[model samples]
Target: MAEGQEKPKRLYQVWKGSNRFFCRGRLIFGPDVSSLITTIILIGGPAVSFCIKVNHTINVNKKDGKDSNYWYIVLFVAALLTCLDILFLLMTASRDPGIIPRNTKPPESEEGFDMNTPSMEWINDRTPHLRLPKTKEVIVNGHPVNVKYCDTCMLYRPPRASHCSICNNCVQKFDHHCPWVGQCIGLRNYRFFYMFISTSTILCLYVFGFSWVHIAQNKEGILKAMRKDILSDVLIVYCFITVWFVGGLTIFHFYLICTNQTTYENFRYRYDKKENPYHKGIGRNLVEVFLSKIPPSMNNFRAVVCEDDMVAEAPSADHVRTSKEKIDIEMGDKFSESNGISLPEILQNLHYDDLEGNSKDKERSVDFDIHPSPFVFELGKRDELVIAHETENIHQV
Candidate 1:
């Protein structure tokens, strides 16, 4: 590309192992492959141990002239649990983690409004000071919660949405990134992820118990057992330790589901005194989080506001007639006192720029919009402004 020419936008690539690739962002696979291989090994090791123990138990029972029906039952239960574990694992690993789409049509209600269409709604008295972590702190339902904004997606994020650095997209109801599953625990796959952990923990305990029983039935106890045929005994010890980790995760997620809190919120808002807004009653929370039916076309909804809409009402003039025309609209006291209107807490700290960059010879005109929240200002020579998307971490100044 020539120095002055714009670079072609890179096409977003989906993760190779994903079942569907509807989200537009870079998919990272470096850590995923290893995590997947580890999960397979963990699942396979127990089954192999069960098979070896069953064979050894059958042989001992035959020599001692005892019924081997108990061993068969144990084998059946272990196999069944293993299958369930695999099923949920696949569901979690491949399912879309609820990617929030970007670059669609502007919302219906905001359609007729241009950049200069001023509304008293932005300066209303009912706004709250509550800030969501990574979003435009728009007052919704009387509270100033953060509306979603992803710099990577170059779009607004919806409520209960967050960006996964690993997946490189904003996910709805984001729980946490799970290395074990090689995926994000999000709205679409969170229930299945929980089930997988719960079943895996149960399977470990069940197989451990049966393996111990088979080992105890041998002529020599675990201590005196031969070094060669102690595979069942070894597997029991492994499960005994591994179960604690998996069981702890299951219990933690169970508590999260019951409280209608995500793993992200649990860590981020640990000390906040206010109750979680998403929480309902315990039963309702469980039902909604686990059993709610998701529509296939949920990803189709998008947030699209064109650059043209931003500059439609911008002034054509290059230079203001006087320095007095350059106004600072963000200071709530000055703006409110001058205009005799109370500004909302969100719009109280607004600032305006007449020029795009530090060049004295060139002039610019600007207009601001709060929905997408990027204040577009025309720069000298260029017909468009190319301000980078602001990240949530930048405090509203």
Candidate 2:
């Protein structure tokens, strides 16, 4: 690929090894099950347990011996049902539904050359369902080609997506790959990912509250319950440990969500020099994260979520503009208060005597978006000269 030209998408053969025998996506099952297990404990387990207690109480009040036993059966059945539901979801989430035709419409482009031929296919053929990595081979085209690879898709990965080794699979839309999820939390599963997090939090809260009730109720009967040492009572102890674990994590994640930061970012960007674009403080973060306030006026989602194939494609003027504008906005602002905002924290932590690099420009815009950045932070005060330097770096790069 030439400078400023799109890289052609390459094709690759799908790994034909017995997918079921070894590891296709089946290998990921461990992590998948881990996520589901957490979700089940955090989501359905408490809900069912609560229902069981209610039903058990009502049956006893009605003086119906058969009905009371029926409630116990109900508890067993509900537990079984929840387990089955999780199994079903796992199976479905694991399958590779063959590739659907790409309906990718290019953003309004000023550059010429219509590559949007309906017949062209950029994904894997064999495992249309699986993402196969592609490789390159030179071939002559009748006409001079602007790029061997499709501009929309980056380097030619075959059925597999060109996952940022960091994110792993070339997840669909590939929203910043999360290592914890153990899969690409992309467009296809974005809803599930969010649902998983949201539901997990709620389940934790419910389990935490519900466990307290059982702790109180069972405390009087703890020795009596231990007398039998039945598996059902064992589950209760497991539930108690689970309650504390999930409760702490869920509350921490809630704080992160309200601030529009992922757990990944919480540690990942702690020492970074640039500011996070998504952050808007606790109140604004909560509003946007929970309420889905996708700032109509500030639609910057595209910067991070274009197709995996499209990353490193020549960034459009609009993207450049968005990036430039964001940098300008950052540079224009003053890092005033001493709150927990990441940029300010980074700035505040720096000491003039401890710094060595150029510290002349303190008014430059600070952007945390660029990778392999050259524009240095104000180790002392490079901020002034940094924004324009960033704007230039972005446009030229």
Candidate 3:
């Protein structure tokens, strides 16, 4: 509030999701950032050993008056692959994973709903009050698909979008939350994530193969050759185990890419059982995943947001009440006072069968008060109305 003082806070400082920001908010990471440390150790440790072994092999070849240039090339290729793998890993981890911004409140407008459509009719008419449907039918690629409403995000998830529980945010075109990368794989960074794993597979194989070559060149038994350079044995075992992980991941993701499916969808939806509406041919799927231009991030984490825009002590989506729910609660309180009955007692006594039988009689006995207003209203106007109502009640008291 003072002159010459910073009044606004950067968006990252007040971000509600369990994400970490770095490089002045230019990079975003998930809650398990420490996983990246393990990744680095796994990569860098083996690379150092590989380089040392290759260099030593080259030196022995030179001392024996044999061509060492081949070994030099092998060392160079291994180093290059290691560096490339690390670069891809960083790209996948730091970039935005296509997080969708959270709404300040649940949407009140009937933008996506059709009240007059017979298909929208409730299956259960026994309910006391109307509530939003759990799933809505959407058309994707000329086929009707049902998309579930995410209660935590308070929105219908876009086609292929899902909420990452680890990141605590809804991501567009979500693949999965990858702990190895310490990031969610989604629309923005999934390409890089795939590249990282594939490159890692290549690097592991490269090291594994050359480590064997180093052992074979000794022309001794396997045990004697391994005893001569224990690092080679260590690398062989390490890369062998590592290849199964990263290599298997590479193949699995290749299948996903070719099929135009995400890990989340492949596992949960099981497109094998049903037709995959998103499947273009394999060629087109490859182009869509690898060659398509990525969209820019929805959030500007470094942007300074004013106090009015900042939602201090913001409630989670589950705790935040919708306008309809608030109205129902207030009406319930008023009804309880008038009838000299607690809200819980009234609820316990209310029966669906009785309501169905006495619907016509209750309509005659109960006088209804209703108002017509625009479905959408400005937040400022809503705040003003709330303040005025509170002031009137204070005066009465």
Candidate 4:
């Protein structure tokens, strides 16, 4: 018998040795050490609390000659809620959060723009005036929206998407990163996340009420009985206090759903002069966020309202080509896709001053009789040196 027990104990130790478990090429258990500890606490804490409460109820019922029917019903309800809480928690923790797919192709209009062609009526009022040179700009819902290219994801971030520094992925309709849950609250898993917190709040409330009643009914007063049944009463009090925070979160999420806003959007644009562009009516917002079965990012609609004044004025062709050549010289032939710098990183550092400087200098240099065309200057290993240009932007030197 001792040998049989030892064999099983050795097997258990072997199983527990690894931090990961796989089933059919899927990770069924284990993420990281912190998550593992969190999972154990979430699943184990409730289970142990339930067991202690059940044991205490059984003992006290026998002493009083009372049936355990009420206690059994309360336990049954609590257990059911626990199962649901675990189910939603796991679903939220494991599921994908609608990461935007990386853009694979270069952005160019399939057909060249025809100014003569009739514009789409549905285009945003701000669309007609928005112009970004050497970059694709699209008109959506009357607004001219810049199609921002992402360097890390190596794709264009569609509107309403932002890069999560923690996850290192662009999540569409990103809500927020929840450390407590050890995951991002985003498009795909948001429903499950909401359900988990809501259910957990209910479970906590139910357990607290039942445990309080059980302790109160004892011959001793609530405080003395609580001291006597320390584990069960302590769990009840802990859950009772915790329920407020969880319940508040549930209520807050419900408000966000109603407003058709994510936690990210709420924080980012909370005090912005404009209302949330995504805000449909309250009825539609709730349906869209919570009740609607449609996938959140399926439509991929970007709700940007661009201002007309922000558009850049087109520069002369000679200046544009000359500046382009100057930039190419400065960047050199080595700045290819495989180069050290990423496009997104370059763009992030790009300022309106950089673009304006080249154009302004070209015009200024011509006026001062410095050169007919802008001198292509390179900041070499030592310092700035001017490189002569032939045939202007006609060909690279």
lDDT of 3 by residue, 1-397 (tens): 8989986789888887899999889889999988998998899999988998889888888898999889889989988998999999999999889886654444333222333332222222222132343443434544445444455544445556677879988787788999899999998899999999999999999999989988887777877999988898899999999999999999999998898888987776557567876788899889887887776676889999876666323334455445542221100023223444322221122111112112434232221111001011123432110111100101000
lDDT of each: 0.54, 0.34, 0.66, 0.50
- 10 residues in a row with least lDDT, candidate 2: 138-147
Better of 1 and 4 by TM-score: 1
lDDT ranking, best first: 3, 1, 4, 2
Residues 274-322 of candidate 4: C-alpha lDDT, one tens digit per residue: 4444566788877666775534332111222223212122223333233
Q: List, residue by residue over 1-397, the lDDT tens digit for candidate 2.
A: 5799654432111211111212422332213334645555554655565566646555664784434564455455545545554554454344321111111222122211223232122232211231211112211111110111222222222111223333222222233443345344432343345545444444444444444444444545766644543433544565567656545665766766565554444654521664444456788656544454221111111122223433222324432223322221111122222222222122223222212233434454222221111111222232221221111111110
Residue-pair clash count for candidate 4: 5
Question: Top model by TM-score, which number?
Answer: 3
- Candidate 3: minimum summed lDDT over ten consecutive residues — where? 388-397
- Model 4 TM-score relative to the real fold: 0.58
Per-model TM values vs. the true structure? 0.62, 0.39, 0.73, 0.58
Instruction: State the displacement of the C-alpha of residue 261, model 3, in Å, after optimal TM-score superposition.
Output: 1.0
TM-score winner between candidates 1 and 3: 3
Query: Residue 338 CA error for candidate 2 (Å)?
Result: 31
Can you tell me which runs of candidate 3 are displaced by over 4 Å? 4-6, 108-130, 311-397
**Cα deviation of 161, candidate 3, in Å:** 0.7
